[model samples]
Target: MPFDFIFNFLTNHSLSFSNPSTHLSYFGSRIICYHLPHNSHRNLSYRSILFLLTIDTLICQNCLLNQQLYASALLHSKSMILLFSLPIIVLAYVLCRNIKLYYDLHRRGLNPQFDIFGIKGLMWLDSSAAHENFTRMCSVIGDKTFSVLRGATPVVVTNDVDLIHAISTEHFDCFHSRIPEVLSDDPITSENIHMFSAKGERWKRLRTLTSYGLSTVKLKLLFPTIETCVSEFLDHVNSLSNGHSVVINHSHSLFQNHTSYVLARCAYGHKEKNHRVNNFLGVFSNAFGAFSDFQKSTAEKITYFFPEMRLIFKNSFVGHFLQSANQQKFLDYLLHLISRFRSRTINENNNKPSEKEPDNYSLLEFFFDHHNEKKLVEKAEGQIDMKKVKVEKSISYQEITAQCKFLSVAGFDTTANTLTLLFNFLAHNPKIQDRIFNEEIKSHSDKIDFETVCSLPLLQNCIFETLRLFPHASPLQTRICTEPLQIGKYEFSENIQVVINPWGPHHDRDIWGDDVDCFRPSRFEKLTEQQRKAFMPFGVGPRQCVGMRFALLELKTTAFRMLQKYVVKTTLPVNDSHGKMVNMTVRDTGTIWPTDKLGIILTKRNT
Candidate 1:
């Protein structure tokens, strides 16, 4: 009775006024609307009826067509969006992978305590701060070596003596050239190849060629020229201070002028009549000021941080040309000297053998004679091996002129500053000054020959002590690692950079003892051979300063002259109003010089 009631209810609810062309039926709960003949459902039996269910409504054709169109459009839009986003997804994945790889590489070594960004590495941000920060880290961390990111590049800084000896001397072949690897072969950068920046076979040739010019024998030959300058210098000072202690403002100026004169006479063959010392001085000062712009450039700082940055700008239109008017004047002066030398050589050759000519010539003239007489390929010591003298390329005029300019730059500031600081040191310590005068100056004041200058033990120690306390060259020496080498427990790869801070070793209490910070001249006498290695004022190894003898000679000569004349004392400040005698604190420029004028009371020595 319940089934019959349900069927009657469905039949009554279903529309009776249906079209004859259509029939309604149900399969489970789903309704099906179909077109059929008028008696299509009449043949259906009770068994069929039991299998089917009642339907409530018929499906519309137009509504189904609209629904299908909407679904297709939605799918197409989704596909287009996904297609457009594929490149972005790939880019993101690649970026993430590289960042992770770099992070892994960066953490491999001993890192400093500071977590600064790339700005610290960009040394132009603050060079003194950068050097000081690094020195501080080395002191605080107390490690032989540590890694730091200078810009994007990673470098290892060390003060280990064994490692320094290995790289600079024992394994010298593997690490010869400096970093920020010579990217440009253009004239602005490399046309004039000097010893300091030369590489490989060129470096060997230049070194061998220039060595004799600064040789012990050559220095002896040039001693008279240096003595003349020292005498002139002493006379100049005497003229200025007529039996009174005068406030000499530019102590550096007098020394600089003397060095310039020495270079002009001994290096350039320019006699007093043709001398261009004043002209050279003006050009050098201006040129040095111009080139120092590199220390402030972002690009150069980045290059200092990452040597490989050279690769990025190697072919760029931008250039590092020396555009200063002073640079042009210097080049012109060199040209003029070359022309005069050539004319003189030609005239001398044309003259008869009986003709009398002055035999006095300069180191540069000797170089010129060698260049002309020698063949293109000459046997010289190899960069790595002393025993194996390899055939090297001949030198050129460009190279010689380049060397002259380089030497002038290298020696001027260093010698001038050293002389200034030496005087300052002697002024502050009158006992040392008296000992130098009594032992060195008085002993050889009349003679003052080469041997006499070299014979000053106490004065030499004072000079050495001043050098140790304030070195002209930065304590940080940067060298490119040519081959893979292991330092202590760490392994370094080829083509990487290694920074050696001599300051760390020089100032280390453990190495130099408790009195390391004090300016004690006697410290040198007590230092062991190993301890002595820590004092590298002129650097070390094959790349040690070619002009070391020249610089030391100049320093000794100046100090001797000053001590011979004046019993000096530093003029202390009166209640901090007039300022301290001279701020012993050094301004860390390309060379180290005092911040203030070195004021001294130079009482004329009782004759």
Candidate 2:
């Protein structure tokens, strides 16, 4: 009891002691006494004794640590030096890399760099004012090729036909892929990647399969589907006319409806107007915002600006896209179709699919035939996992969904707007309309077949000329240099975007003579071989629109037939609100639309 009491008394006294004072020192040994304050420790309970010991231990440790810290602060350590230098090193590296890029592009690379830098080039994403500005600047610089900034990214914009051919064909390997859209790298989000966004082997595989499937021979399978839709659309217009010329309000909407129906039949195999049919039309309209000006979602904008943030923004960029309910449904609907395709093709004896039906051919099914897997479609009854569907040698479910969705929409705004421009032009210029009809369509036959329309040169030239004047895809046509690309004396670095406005060459006086502004289709005849191949409305070379033949077939056929039936008539002058079709060009995010509703009259011919 005495030992315990003594121990507790001394420990509690140490806890209340002031800083230790050295009394005597000899060699390294020293006698230090901690002077205690006159304090009371009357509570002699076990808990009180334990608390005093803990406090005394902490005070002793604090005194030792302070002395060690004082010594460390005076001596320079390697870790401390690194801590101070790391940030500066990183900043210097970035600055040096940018400086090298500038020297490589401007001085050594012979690229005439424009002064506009920073966020000014983000106009390409905004897709309007900046684009128009770039087009104007092309003239100010007075050169066919120049370098500009797309939000600090270097973009080599060119209108030189010879250089374009070299990049697109002669030296395609140097500039094959496009700049990616900064999508999620989530394996499941691979569904959002399409042929346009793919790189390397994936691009080649997708391109090969789709190009063959969309060939003339393969597309012939869907001729009846296209024919029926086109005929029905014409009939609907006839009904709306009431046996007289009628100004079709918002003609693009009519074309949009027609495109939806076409996709419903061609992509989903929905022939009838079934309300519950899986047309996949709602997927675009409800989910991705369809033909209208689809403002990018906040998640999309964030991902685009900060691509490294993809991990955080993955869910919003692809797969379900919860921000839009229809996006989930759209993907699920495609998987369901794949499930059904599996059931019909599979022999039911094993996991592998069986024989394919000879007539089972559609844009969506074509992809399934070429590249398909079963896991994603496991839950045909409900939503299924988007991942776990990777195949060793074929395309995936998302690729099929994305590519077919792209093919289906090719006719919507692009084809529709082209037709809109064509009809409007014909209505304004009666002489041109009469000449085309009397010379091309009527000259062939009262009801010309598609094969016959394809042979008509005059009608083709008119359509080509209209596309030249308003190349909707001009602003969107772009390619990322894959390697060091050299065209004549100039060279480009990898990741440099080879862009074109098309508005330049298409309207250039040097290229098209002084009558560049004139409504002349005959200029195409005078153009050289290279100049003739330069009319790239759908883009140029191998990377051109996969649905080009299909779109062109529909365009030429529809234009020919429309001319055959109705004489395009308009009472409005050349420059009314919608009358000035040229001024009404409202291009946004690769879509060319008009500012207001387009009003054009379709007068039935007295055939």
Candidate 3:
């Protein structure tokens, strides 16, 4: 319609001209006819037409530019969406694969029943069944590397014997035991020189010092003290048995008490009465309970996905009560004992006018003498060179206290637990127990010396069997890899922690026969030299238990004296309260002890 309007207007206004150029000029002049209409209305009309054409040109250019920008923006939006979504898609696929692997492993019966978390099993194994379950899990997994729940934290479990050997021996420096932060938060942890607390140089020094103290010569020197403690323990037991049936929680009150007295006299030069209430035994028992509880709680919390809850839960009444009362009381008592010794030493030194005063024959005194002599040697060497030098001595007040405290804590409990379990085993297996008794009696009628007791083959076998079936510390010994270690087929990187389950290895079907769980002392007799080496009840290599000889002596003497007078028996049904024994120690509660309470029916054996 616009085209028709333009044509009609042009045709009606047409003025014919001769040449084409002349015609275009004539049309241009006629198109501006509105401006030359000889009136103001015509001029206004011409300006309106020019303004409309300018606006049209600007609008068309803007439309074309906007179309190009919109297309480019759409392309960029698509690229960004793809880039961000790619990672999510990959993550989803990986998660699905992991879940599938977990299910497949489970469905194939390759999963350990106790490993509920699929990472590491629970941190606390308080039952024999749990121990058994863990062993089974390791066997089924049979992999160089696998994961299990240590409470909530996932720990990678390895059955690589090479790794175990490396950790136990080659990489001993890297694989030292870890002391939980909670335990170290208090002075008790700091001042205790127990094997658990000893690490690096401090550990090395204390270990060397204690090793000397527990040497064959020192043990012989300490024989009388040990005998005295054991006699007292036997007397206590005899007094309690009135020819009637008696219930004995030997692990808790009796054996633990006796061991405490032995350590007290042998290590600290103090002999506290074990039978009395509120003595060292009582305090130690309370302290141990507190320590165990604290460890369990810490292990549980740290393994949790949300470990920050530990801080919030720290204000709980039980937590505060243990820290303020039990822990603090133990520390205060230890510090007081250390102070008393220091005062005595100071007075003795002051009283001696002569420089050649003979040293007192106490462990503490010996330590101080050596420590001072070391300082003197260092000072003399420095003076000869005219060099300023500082000599750090052994037996610092703190070191002495820590070492003594460690002895008191570790020595007593572990030995007591072992003895108690052994006793329980002897009580149930009267034939084996009686053989040990007869051997002890034949060795020495009145007094069984260290050498005599150590010679009894039957007694040694019994002890070895007890240690194997009911090791005090059940889990495989752990060590961190300090340097790269090659054990057998595998290589472990430095700083990775490795654990060897002694219980697992001891009970392994490949190593032991199908009757591995049976209480058989004769297994030792059948073992080849290689097998015997593998059966390390007290561990192996340089870092083995320092006080093993002392522990054996104590066990032999205590077992001999107890058995000579009494025939241990169980009056209660064997399986009635078997559950309580699970958390007690690694020993077999049922086989070693009767169910209700450990009833040792004492009968006077006429010599």
Candidate 4:
């Protein structure tokens, strides 16, 4: 037999070596000596078989020992890991369960109230808990006194009209805008004309600047620019229609473009040629993508959990991008415009130029005039720091730019969302849509003037009802108390945040009656003269939306023009999901755009 065959044959037959000790001894002695190869070929073959048997025996013995050792280590390691992590996991589960239980209990009239320490107490009024928890808080607390939330923060929850009016209007200075950590953390937020800014002098100065720059007169002057943009928008829509039914993403590209163009033109006196297809819309789209990614990170969750995360991550990718692109663009554009306007004004002033002026009137020009007046006052008073005054003078340019950018973002998305809601409502309630259409037709003569458009009472009512039922900035308004103040029987100390739940108030049965959820425009019509004062869609008091007029005009004008041109219909079954809206401004944040699965189809209307 071959040497290999002999080795295998011997190894297989080795099982017959009955005594384990005898087998080991024979293998070791033969295997150790046979490698010398001084004997015959049979001796060599026997030696090779002995060597193979010895190696196999040793490997088997080692493997058996290792297997037992590994099993014992694995069992011990598993038990230790379980022991270490079990309590932590259990604690997390218990806390989450308690939160849910507390929320549920509050929702169902249990009225269990407790306070835990820290800033996380704001979580009680956060959007996640607002719907149920806030409602329960309002019912149980009843505006009698401010309750301290878990995190050592005091909060006042109320639906009482007198108390709300007192806090929002009468003693407005005592309970000014909320100072959110997000706003205070970023320079853009700190420097901008956000609604969340401090009250009194700072708010007064900013508000005055904004009013001058974005005033009704200014908006009226800018109307032609908006009209031109909207005309282009209509053309784009017509081109897209192309005789075939098309599914359009209304909130994304189309609205974004129109809005960007409107802002660029109105704010900077510059309009990009492909604003609808490129420019700020693209920037916003990219920024939103980056925002979504950043939001997914554990860092984002931590930042949300602790406001101090904002301090650490002040230069977050999303925040920086927003400031650089949106904030910086507007700032630079405004500053450049201001410089040019100031140079031209200086030349004109020296020459005693006529008040008739040039065609390129801008918001910057208004600001320049306002700044001059302020400078004159400071000069006469002799209390001015020329350096600080110079800085303050440049503020208008930056402030107006910030406000304009905010309008572009806030006004655009909210208006589009409101329009979507209105259209969805009309799709379901054809009668109401028809009423609006008929009113528009009746109101429009050969030419529609501003006064004629404004005169349509029913149209106004329809718009009001749509806004009330589906307010775009549903839960956006927040305010922090700077000083201890009483609202009804509740006394809220300084640093306590108050959230004005517009959606809750709008949907409240006590406020709007049992049919509050229903889309009944007649409800607005039937509102007693006294009741109308409490129904604030644009909010109330001095800190109310500054761009309310502009937004209203845009919405009304768009609705009227669309009604004049086309009758909107939906191919997809008109459902809530198809017309779902989101609250962008307030406590919660998510995909606020209407889904692609839902949309309205428009057909030409006969005059």
Of the candidates shown, which would achieve the greatest TM-score relative to the real structure?
A: 1
Q: Alpha carbon lDDT of residue 472, candidate 2? A: 71
Model 2 agreement with the true structure over 1-607: per-residue lDDT tens digits: 4336535655566545442221111111111113333332332453544445455555667889998997887565767888899978856754565456566678645464643332444544355443455567777877777775543456777877888878777776666677655443422235556777665545666777777777878767766666766777787788777667777777666665666776666666654653323255555555543332225566655554344556676655452463456665765775676567556545432654665443456776666656655333211111112233232335677677777555554555687677777776677778878888887767565555547856777778878888877777676677877666567978777667777667667766766777666567766667786567667788877688887888777777788778888898765675322222455343423555654455688998876
Q: TM-score of predicted model 2?
A: 0.73
- Candidate 4: give the clashing pairs: 116-150, 117-151, 118-151, 145-490, 178-479, 178-480, 476-586
lDDT of 4 by residue, 405-440 (tens): 455566556666666666666766677778877755
Off by over 4 Å in 2: 1-100, 110-117, 184-192, 274-283, 288-326, 332-361, 372-396, 443-447, 574-581, 584-589
TM-score of each: 0.73, 0.73, 0.66, 0.65
Model-by-model lDDT, in order? 0.63, 0.62, 0.55, 0.55
Quality of model 4 by C-alpha lDDT: 0.55
Instruction: Report the error of model 1 at residue 383, Å.
Output: 9.8
Lowest lDDT sum, 10 consecutive residues, model 1, at: 573-582
Ranked by lDDT, the better of candidates 1 and 4 is 1
What is the alpha-carbon lDDT of model 3 when measured against the actual structure? 0.55
Candidate 3 lands at a TM-score of 0.66
